[model samples]
Target chain A: MSDFQFDKIALIGIGLIGSSIARAIKLHGLAREISISTRSPLTLARAEELELGTFYTESAAECVKDADLVIVSVPVGASGAVAEQIAPALKQGAILTDVGSTKASVISQMQPFVPEGVHFIPGHPVAGTEHSGPDAGFADLFEGRWCILTPVEDTDAEAVRKLRSFWESLGSRVDEMDAEHHDKVLAIVSHLPHIIAYNIVGTAEDLETVTESEVIKYSASGFRDFTRLAASDPVMWRDVCLHNKDAILEMLARFSEDLAYLQRAIRWGEGDKLFDLFTRTRAVRRSIIEAGQDIAEADFGRHIRHEK
Target chain B: MSDFQFDKIALIGIGLIGSSIARAIKLHGLAREISISTRSPLTLARAEELELGTFYTESAAECVKDADLVIVSVPVGASGAVAEQIAPALKQGAILTDVGSTKASVISQMQPFVPEGVHFIPGHPVAGTEHSGPDAGFADLFEGRWCILTPVEDTDAEAVRKLRSFWESLGSRVDEMDAEHHDKVLAIVSHLPHIIAYNIVGTAEDLETVTESEVIKYSASGFRDFTRLAASDPVMWRDVCLHNKDAILEMLARFSEDLAYLQRAIRWGEGDKLFDLFTRTRAVRRSIIEAGQDIAEADFGRHIRHEK
Candidate 1:
C-alpha cells in the first residue's frame, strides 16, 4: 500500500490496458470507486456493460474529477488531449500516469498539460496481447510482467515510490529507467519487432506466386508466429511508430544491416555463417525461459494449450 | 487404409519428427513392427529407452532391411546420405519418404539413390516445435497439420496413395505440389520467417546499447514471438537456406524492400502509410485463424496455457 487507500481511480481510456487495469483493481479491491472514460461512446457503453467501473463516461474531464489516481490509457497521439481535458478536473495531489508503450514522447506529450498539483509520473507496463478493446482485457495481464516507470528528474520522490508500489500491487515488478533510455530499449525490444512483423506479413500477403491459402495452410511451420504480433492494434502501433520515430529508425537500420549480412550468407552458400547465427539465437530463448519470462513447452505447447 | 497393412516400418533419424511419427504410428496401431535408427548412438539409445520402436539400430541400412515403410526424418542436409545407405536394404515396392523442409533439394539429393522399385516421395509435414530430439516427440504433433508431398511424375500412383493414407492415419491433410513450386511456397511461408526471426534475435543480441537482460525482461511485448522461431534447429535452418537459395533470396529481397519502404514511412512520419499496412496485415492473421491454422486465443492463449 501507498500508506493511504486510493479513494478513487480514474481510467481515461478503457481499452485493453485500461480495462485490464480496471479488472485488476476490482480483483484486488484497491480502489474505493473506479471511474472509466473513453472518447468513443460505444466503447464507453461497452465498458459499462462489462461492469468495468463504478463510474463510466465519455468525458475525460468527468472521469478524473475528484479521483485520487488518474491513469491515462490512450494512444500516444491522444495522450496530450486527454491530459488537457482532465488537467483541471484532477484532484490535488492525485497521481497521474499512463500505460503507453513509449515513454519519452509520452512524457513530453502529457507532461506540459498536467496540472501543477497533480503528481505526474509516466509508467509503461510491458504487457499485452495482440487483441485490443475493453473486451480484450483480463485481471492477470500484468501478472509476472515488467512495468517500467520513467519518472522525470526533480519529480517528488514520494510520488515515484507510491507509483511504484501501486504497480507492484497490480502484480508487476517495477524498474526505473530514464525516459530516453526507455525509448531506446523499447525500440529494439517492442517497436522494431512489431514493425518488422507487420512488414513481413505484408510482404507475404503481397507475393504474386504464393496463394493466401497456401501461406495460411503452411503457417504453422514458422510464419504463424509473426502474425500474432502483426495482429496488434493498428492505431496503437501507428502511434508507436510516429512517437518513437528516431529510436525505431535506429533499430530498423541495425536490423536491415544484419539481414543484409544474412542474405549474403544465404546467397554465397555460407552454411556455417547461417548455422552460427541460428545456433547463437537458441541461447537467448533458453535465457528467456530461465528468467521465467516464457513457457518452455515445445511448439509453445500450442497443441496441449488448445485443449483447455 | 492403404489396402494393405504396414507390415514393418522403419524410421531413420529418431529426432523430433521421427520420434513423433513413431508415436503417431504406435497410437494408431498402424504398423506391425517399427525399426528406428540414427547416426548418433545416444539418440538411438534414447529412442529405444522411450520405447519409440520395436527395433533400434545404428546403421540406416540395417534399420530399413525388408521394411515396408521407411521414413527419413533426418536434417535436410542428411537426406542424400541416408537415402544412399538405406537404398540397398529397402524392400521391393516399399514406400520411401523423407520429412525434409526443402522438397526440391531433398528430391534432388535422394531421388538418384532411391531404388528403382521403391516409391521415393519427398514430403514435408508443416508441424513441429522449437525443441528437437527424441524426447520432444508426441503422437499429436501432426494432428490437424498440413503435409505437402512433391513426387516425381513417373512415381507410382498406388504408392503415393498409400503414403498419403499413412499420413492421413497419422492425422495430416495431404497436398501435392511440384517440387519447385513447393520450394517457392515454403520459402515465403516457412524459410523467410525463420531467417528473419534468427536475424532479428541475432541483431538484438549483438547490440551494445540495449543490455541483454533488458531485452529478456521485456521480451513478451513482441520479441519473444521471434525467439521461438529463432530457437529452432540450427542445422535444419542452415540446410533450408542452402537448399532453397533462390526462392529464399527472392522472398528476402521482397521483405527487405518492404522493410525499407516501411522504414522510409517511419522516417517521414507517414502515419497513414504505417496504419494501412498494420491494419491490412491483421486480416491475414484473421484468415489464418478462420482457416483453422492457428488458435484464436489472445497472445496465443499463453496465460491459460501455462496453468497446465
Candidate 2:
C-alpha cells in the first residue's frame, strides 16, 4: 500500500466491471478515495450500501470532479453519454479511460468529448465471468488476465504508463494496442463466441422436434457448456454486438462458413473429416490450459468460480 | 446382496462406460461372476490391474460363454463387428444390450448378428464426462442420470425389466423410447453441440488474423467453455456423427437457419431481437439447474472426496 498512486478514482456505472475494479483497487489500496456514480438511483443506493466507494452520487459529473483517474464502465452503447456527462467535471491532466469490451466504438464515442488536458485512453480487461452486477464482482477477477489498453496515436506516454501501473497494481497484465486491432482481435475471441453461444441456445429453445426440457436434461453431454456463456449479461452483449458489428460479422461469417462445411461432412458421412476436425480442436484446449488462461488446476474451475 | 439378479455378466468393451458398470455391479453384487473382454491386450491388462472383473479374456466370444447378461460398450461404428464376433458364443436366452449413443444405427448393425434366443436391446446412458478410457471410470458416474432403452419389436419384456433393474442398481433412471426418437433427441442435445464446438474451435485455430495464443489467452471470456466439449473423445463423437447422420443433419439444418437469422439481426443492429433471444435462453439454464442436471455439486463433491 505504500505505492498507492492515485489520490482519487471515479468509477462511472458501478456494475460488474466497475465494482470489480473497485474491489481490486480497495484490496491493493491503489487509490486514496473512490467515487462511484451510476445512472439508476437504485444502483447508486446499492453501491452505497456495498460501500464500494468513499462517495456515491447519481451525477457522473460530480463523481469525476477532483479525481485523478476516471473509469467509464458503462455498456459500449452508453460510452458517448457517459463521456458527455463527465467531460465537464474531469480534472485537467487526469487519466480518463474505459473498460468497455469493444474498443473502436469506445474510442469513437469518447475521444471527441475529451478536453485537451485529459488523457482519453480506451481499455478493456479481457476478463470476467458470465455473472453481472456489483455482487458478482471479486477482488481477483483480473488476476493474471490480460488488460488490453488501446491508446490512440499521440496519447501521452506518461498517462499510458500510469494506467498500466494502475491495472498492474490490480493484478492485471497490461498490454497496449490500437483500438481497431483490439476490436478485431476481440471480435473473434470474445464477441463471436458469445454470439454463437446465444444463437445455439436460442436454436435449442426454438426446437419443436426436441423439447426444451430434454435439452436441459441431457445438456451435461455438451449443450450445457454453451448455457453458461449464453447466460451472460444480455444488455452488455447486445451492446457489444452492435458496437463491434463489422469485426463480429466478419468472424461470424467465417464461423458460419466453417460450420456449413462441417455440417456437409456430417451429412455426407465424411467420418474422416469430422475426426480430423475434432482431433485438431483438442490441441487448442491444451494450449489454453498451458497458457494459464484457463484454470489448469481443475477441469471445472471456470464454472466453479462463476457459481461462487 | 440377495436381490442380485444376473448369474453371469459379460462386458465386451472395458473402457470408461464398461469399467464404470463393472465397478457398480461389483459393489452391489449384481452378478455372481463378471467377465471382461477387450480387443486390446493393453486395455485388458489395465482392466485386470483395476480388478474390474472376476475374469478377463482377449476374445469377446470366449468372454461371453455361459454369460446370462452381455453389455457391449464400444464405438458405434464397431458395434456390428463386435456383435458378429460374439454372436455365436452368446448363451441362449441371454439379454444382450449395448451402451451406444446412437441407437438406430446400433440396432441396425447388431440385430442381424444376434441369435434368435438373445434379447437384443439397444440402450444409451445419457451421462459421461469428456474424459475417456478405463482409468477415467468411477462407480458413481451414472448416479441420478437418465438412461434410455430403445428395444426392438418382439424384444422380451422380462429382459427389458431385468436391464432396467441393472441400470437402476447403477443409479440411472431408465426410460423407454424408439430408436429414431432417441437419435433426434440426442442430436439436438449432445451431437450438435459437440459439432458446433469442434467447428468454432477449429475456425478460431485457422484464423491468421487472431493468433491461437491470443484466443487461448483471452478464452476465459466464453471461448474456453466450448473448448472442454471440443476436447471430448474424437473417436466416440465421430462414430456418433457417422452413425446418426440424418438426425444430426436435421438438427444442424435447423441450427444453421436460426444462426443465419441471428446473424442478420446482428448485421442489421437489431438489439431488441438479440436481447429477447438472449433472455429467453437464460430460462433453459434455470430449468437445467432446477432439474439438478448441472448444479456444480459434482466438482465440489470430487474435491471433498479426493481430500479425504
Candidate 3:
C-alpha cells in the first residue's frame, strides 16, 4: 500500500511549528501541494522567502480552499478565531488538526466551527526548542519525539489512523489519549516547568542584592539551565496559561505545597528529609536517559569533548 | 615570572572537584606530586584506579603532611571536620583552600583550626555537573568558569594572590568577594535552583494522577531540564542546604513569592501579565550567553547536530 499523501496541505500561522511541519512535509514528500498562511504580512513574506510552501497567502480561508488537510499551528488562544475564519473554506471529508499544547481548550474552541464532515483531531507534538519563527524550524524537529493525538468521541476512526500514520512518517511516535488527560499530563510536565522557570528568572532579576551581571556571570553554576525554558516564546506560553488555567493552577498548587515543605525542611535543619527527597528525584533523570528521552552524557553533554 | 607551582599538593576528599583539580594539576604541571584522601575507602580506591593522584591515603593528615598546598574538596558540612583533622600536619606557609559551594560557612568552619602561618582562603569554583565522585571529574571542568575566593580580612595578600593564580592555571577566571556576599550570591544562583528543581521533581513523582512512566516518557517537554539539577548529589546538596541555611532560606522566600504572583496571574487568566514576565526573563539568558557563562545554542546545544 502507498503511504498517506494529502492532495493539498494548508498550514495556518507559519511560525516555528507551522514552518517545521512545512519543512517535514517537503522533506518526506507527504503532500502534493503545500499552502502557507499567516495573519502577519511579515511572517507570510518570511515563509515565502524560506520557500516553505508552493502557495503562500495572507488569508486563512484562501489557504484552506480545496486542501485535503488543514493543520492549525497557531497559539492556543488563537484557535477559535482561526477555526471560525477557515470553516467556510474547509473541504468536505478533510482531516483538520492542531499542534497546540493544551488539548481540551483547543478542542472546545475549535469544535463548534469545524464543519460536519471534517475531522478535527487535536494533537500536541511534545517537542520544541526555546526558539520561534520560520528560521528557527527544521525538518527533523519531530524526530524521536512523541506526537499526541486526542480525538474526541464520535470522530472518524479512519481519519484518526491516517493522522497517526502521517505523524509517524514525520519521525514521531504517535499515541492516543483523551483530551482531558492530555491537558492534565501537559500541565504538570510542560506548563508548570515553564512557569517555574520564568518566575525564578524574574525573582533573580528583581533581587536588589544580586546584580543582573552577577546572575549572568554565575549562571552556569545552575541558574542558566532554567533560563533556556524561560526564554521561550512569550505569546505561545501566555496563550497556554490562559487556555489551560484549571489544570495549570492545580499543578502549580502542588508544586508550591512541595516547595513549602522543602523550605520548612531547610529552616528546621532537617538534613535527612532534604537528602531523601533529593535522592528520590535523581532516579527520574536516570529513567529519562534510559528511555532515550534525554542524552546520556553528563551536563546535557555540552563542552565535554574538550575535557583532558 | 613563572606561575606558582607547589612541590607537593594534597587533595582531601577525592570527589568531582578534587579529581578535577588533580587532573588539572597534572595537565598543567602545576604540582610535582599529588596526594589523594577521602573518608570513603571505596572512593579512595576508585581515585587510585583512575590514577587521579600519585599518593592515596585514608588519613587527611597523612595526605597533607609536608605538602606545599592542600585543597579540601569535601561537602560544606564536613569543612570543620576535615580542617581539624589536617591542621597539625599542614606544612608551614602552605596554602590551604577549599572548593565548597558555600563560602561563609566554610570559612567559619575552617578558620579556627588554621595554624598561625598557614594561609586559608575559602574558595568556590562555580562550575560542576549533576554527576559527582572521582570518576565524574575532568581536567577542563574549570575552563572559562568563575572561581570566587572569600579571603579573611587579615589573610596575607601574597598568599591570596598565589591561590588565585593556582586556580587561574587550572583555567578559571578568579574573583574575590567577601564571604557573606559569596554565600548570598550562590544561594540565589546555584543553591535555590537545585532546591527548586528537586522540589518540583519530587512533586511530580508524588502526584497520584500522573504515572511515573508517563513522566519519564514526556520529560523532554520541559521537566527534564529541572531534572538535571535535581539529579545532583544528594549528600552534597543536603550539606549545602544545612551549611548555607540563612542565605538559601532567604532566596527561597523570594522565589516562592514570585511564583505565587505568577500562579495568581495564571489563575486570573491574565495573558498580558504572563506575557510581560516571560518576555522580561529572556534578556537574562541572552546576557548569560554574552558573558560566555552558557553556550548560545538552544537546549544547551544538545543533540542538535542530527536536525536537518
The positional error of residue B243 in candidate 3, measured at the CA in angstroms, is 0.9
Candidate 1: deviation at residue B42, Å?
0.4
Ranking by lDDT: 3, 1, 2
* Model 1: per-residue Cα lDDT over A35-126, one tens digit each: 99998999999999999999988888998989988889999989888888888888889999999988888988898988787899999999
Q: What is candidate 1's TM-score against the reference?
A: 0.98
lDDT of 3 at A78: 95
lDDT score, candidate 1: 0.91
Candidate 2, pairs of clashing residues:
none
Model 1, residue B33: C-alpha shift (Å)? 0.8
Model 2 lDDT tens row, B1-308: 44558989999998879998999999888999999999999999999999999999999999999999999999999999999999999999999999999999999899989998999989999877666788877777777778999999988899999999999999888889899989999998889988988998999999988887788878866787778888888999999999999999988888889888888999999999999988888787778778777764422222222210
Cα-based lDDT at residue A210, candidate 1 = 95
Candidate 2 C-alpha lDDT tens digits along A18-114: 9999988998888899999998999889888888999999899999999999999988999999898889889999999999999988888888999
Evaluated with DockQ, which candidate comes out highest? 1
Looking at chain B only, the TM-scores across the models are 0.97, 0.95, 0.97
Each prediction's total of clashing residue pairs, residues at least 3 apart in sequence or on different chains, is 0, 0, 0
Of the two candidates 1 and 2, the one with more favorable lDDT, higher being better, is 1
TM-score of each: 0.98, 0.95, 0.98
Candidate 3: stretches off by over 4 Å: A1-4, A305-308, B1-4, B305-308
* lDDT accuracy of residue A251 in candidate 2: 91
RMSD per candidate (Å) reads 1.7, 3.0, 1.8
For model 3 the TM-score comes to 0.98
